[model samples]
Target: MKKTKLLLISLLLTDFVMLLQPENAWAGDVQITCDLRVLELTSQQRNQIRLRRQQYKTRQRQMNENLMNQNVTDRQLSLRHFFSKSAFDNQQADEIAKQRYANDVRQTVAELNFYHDIFQLLDNRQREIWLQQCVQPAGRI
Candidate 1:
C-alpha cells in the first residue's frame, strides 16, 4: 500500500512539472553546423602556398633579427638624463630603429594579408572552422 501511494505521488509531481513548461520553449534556438575538411590541391597550387608561407616565415625572421640587433648606446648618466638632452648625435641610431620598426609592421601586415587571401580559398565549412580558431581577424570582409 505504501509503495502504491508513493508511485501515485511521483506520477502527479511529474505531470505538474510538465504542465509548468510552456509550449514553444525550444523554437527560439538557431544552430549552424558544418564539417571542416581540406579539399584536394594540385601540386602547383600546393607549391604556390608553400612558397607564400615560406616568404612570411622569412619576413618574421628578419623582423626578429632587427629587434635583436638594436644597440643600447646609453651608459653614462648626467644632468642630461633620458629626456633632457637633445638626441642630435644618436639620430642615426634612432632612425635605424624607427626604420626597423616600420619594416616589422609592414611585414606583419603582409603576413596577415597572405593568410587572409589563403583563407578565401576555403569552402564555407572550412572557412567557418578557420574563423572559429582566429582571435583577432585580419579585418572585416
Candidate 2:
C-alpha cells in the first residue's frame, strides 16, 4: 500500500511539472513557419534574412525572460511602480525624459539602418512594386 501511494504521488507530480512548462517549449518548427509567413520572402531572401531574424528572435526572447525575472525581483517591481506613479522630482524627471529621448533615437537609427540594407537589396522597380503591394488598400488589388 505504501509503495503504491508513493508511485501515484510521483506520477501526479510529474504531470504537474509538465503542465507548468511553457507553451513555446516545443515551438521550434512552428516558429520557422511563422517566420516564413511574416517575412513573405523568396527562398534567397529567406536565406539572407534567416540569420538576422534568428538573432533578433533570440535577443527578443532573452529580453522577455529578463523582464520576467525582473518581475520577480521586489526592488525592480517597486522601482517600476514608483515610475508608474509619476512621483519623480524635476531632476529625476529630466533624467527619465533624456533616457526616453535617447532610446527613441536609438530605435529610429536601427530602423533606418534596416531599411537601408533592404533598399540596397532591391532595385528601384522592385522597391516601387513592393511599396505599392504593401501600402495599397486590399480591395484595390
Candidate 3:
C-alpha cells in the first residue's frame, strides 16, 4: 500500500510539471503584438502613426545598407580598385561618404526621437503595453 501511494504521488507530480509547461503550438506564428487599443485615435491619426512607423523602419534599413556600402567602397578605395576609379580621388570619395553617413545617422536619430515622443503620450496602462511590445524579441518574418 505504501509503495502504491508513493507511485501515485510521483505520477501526479510529473503530470503537474508537464501541465505547467508553456504551450507553443503556434510557435513562430505567435506574435505578442500591441496596437493603439487604449487610446482614442482618429483614422487620420492612425494613418499618420502607421506612416511614421514605416518611415522609421525604412530609416533603420537605410542606415544598415549605407554603412555596409560605405565599408565596401572604403575597402575598394584603399586598394585603388577600378570601381574606386583613381587613387587620387579615393580620399575625396571617403570624406564625402563619411559626411553622407553622418547625415543619415542624424536623420535616423530624429525619427527615433519622434517615436519616443509619441510614446510619451500614453497613459500608464498603455505605456506598459507599449513597453512590453518593445521589449519582446523580434519575430521571424
Best by lDDT: 3
| Ranked candidates (lDDT, high to low) | 3, 1, 2
Please provide, for model 1 over 1-141, each residue's C-alpha lDDT reduced to its tens digit, 9 standing for 90 to 100: 999999999999998886644331221111112222233445655676678778878878887786667554442232236346566447655754576467645665665677766666666765666667543322221
Q: Can you write out model 3's per-residue Cα lDDT over 1-141, one digit (the tens) per residue? A: 999999999999998886644332223223334556655555766777787778777877886776666666665665565345644676666876676558545764665565676676556766676766543443432
- Write down the lDDT of every candidate, Cα atoms only: 0.56, 0.53, 0.62
How does candidate 2 fare on TM-score? 0.39
Which scores higher on TM-score, 1 or 3? 1
Steric overlap count per candidate: 0, 0, 0
TM-score: model 1 vs. ground truth: 0.38
lDDT tens readout by residue for model 2, 21-116: 543233211111122333355677666666655665575566556545653466555557657875666775666567435643544444445445
Give TM per candidate: 0.38, 0.39, 0.36
Query: Cα deviation of 9 in candidate 1 (Å)?
Result: 54
lDDT of candidate model 2 versus the reference: 0.53
* Residue pairs with backbone atoms closer than 3 Å in model 1 (clashes): none
Q: Deviation in angstroms for 74 in model 1?
A: 5.5
